[model samples]
Target: SIFASGTNLDVVELWFPRLSDEDQMLAVARFNQITSVQGSAMAVALPGIVETLGTLHARSYRLGVATNDSTSGAEKTLVTLGVAQLFDAAYGYDAVANPKPAPDTIQAFCDLTGLKPTQVAMIGDNRHDLEMARAGGCGLAVGVLSGTGTRESLAGIADVILDSVVDLPDFLSARVKETI
Candidate 1:
């Protein structure tokens, strides 16, 4: 939805324009370079992601993804992963004036969900996510080892570093109980 904005879409198009008619046929092949990595693309949901999302959904927790990816790219990845339905809201790079390092994206998510920043937890794999969570005043910033980020890389930024998204359910389960 936000991707319709001219400023943002222009930037995205500049970086990754639509493939030519001929190249369109090679889209999958080209995409495979990044997505086919052992743990690179979001299309291959990490271990424990489904169960974690299921638990969160079952508990009626509001789930959202605030990412620096374009809306179309985000939707494509989610659909490919078969988990598009799990998120209550999805904000893309074009959703706000500022991206990751800025709190705008996360703030937009909070605004859309009618949730305060303090009620949200940001689960990501990068320094930018941690900075955004902090800037947005999120309840917690959880970093996972599924991506390029390492424990040391996330050292001071994250509130907690998890082995993988799979461990998220247990963490949230405990947190929910504690809050109650």
Candidate 2:
């Protein structure tokens, strides 16, 4: 009955397929309201996040965000941080029928970019992120310790674990050199 793959919103549609569109709107509004409050305190970007994003962009790597947060909310945060233009695309829970761990969002992203799953890497700080990467057949599942997920929780799920996204550029560069 209940799936533990993703957030409550991700499974809400599965459980309540009969829910009226009006009711779904109300639920989304309520969730957005709650997130708005939480987002107030999170307007600021995490340390090294901007630099890492900029560096990744400069390296010609296309970037996209597959967040469970509302699209508007994620966009607002990115805009506020001055990195919105650095991203090629951003998908929220509402963008897909099923969110992370189901791989719908990841598939959508791949389709949009005309890239295969094997050409992509999913970098996240949670099990859902890693699961989504795996389900989508992504080449890499990278876990970070910068969010709520702990090392133990992300272990075995992620192909590699890092202290934070800030370390990603160096890690990727090293991998490229190793292959050369």
Candidate 3:
């Protein structure tokens, strides 16, 4: 089951592999245009997400999003979730010279916050996110089950596997020492 994951560029690359590079670029452009037009309406905020983000924000955690989506797309999703104000920043794949599995997004985050890689925690529901965390030497590699990854797939890769991001604050408070 090759579900849609990664940046729009990556997904579009997968979708149009045999096309000429220019055609692929055009395809990505069209895809992004369609997504910008329809993404917010298609978004579904996971239960407890708003509360979780609010809790983290209120607790003064400098939170940011490092998504594979385009920055605008990620912002739109957050807006749809009613939690756009909770984040300090949101970095899309385009925000970096390299995308996930490359450490670039994590590097961007570290640079923005003046935090060392080891002081940061990386959480996502896919392999690329965990891989990026490891490559960036992050303090934790957390995998959630609410998205594209299965327990079996994330096993032995992520430092800790949780059911969803809703469980993050408590786990981080209690288990910061365990990491990849």
**C-alpha lDDT score of every prediction, in listed order:** 0.72, 0.82, 0.83
Ranking by TM-score: 3, 2, 1
**Least lDDT summed over 10 consecutive residues: which range in candidate 2?**
1-10
Clash counts per candidate, in order, are 0, 0, 0
Model 1, poorest ten-residue lDDT window?
A: 1-10
lDDT of 1 by residue, 20-51 (tens): 74654355334433332422254667766777
What are the models' TM-scores? Answer: 0.75, 0.85, 0.88
Q: What TM-score, to 2 decimals, does candidate 2 have?
A: 0.85
Q: Please say which candidate is ahead in TM-score: 1 or 2.
A: 2
Off by over 4 Å in 2: 1-24, 33-41
**What is the clash tally of candidate 2?**
0
Top TM-score: which candidate number? 3
Per-residue lDDT of candidate 2, residues 61-171 (tens digit): 989988777676677778878999999888877678887677997889889989999989899988989999999999999999998678999999999999999999999
lDDT (tens digit, per residue) of candidate 3 on 89-136: 888777789877899988888898898999888888988889989999
Candidate 3 has an lDDT of 0.83
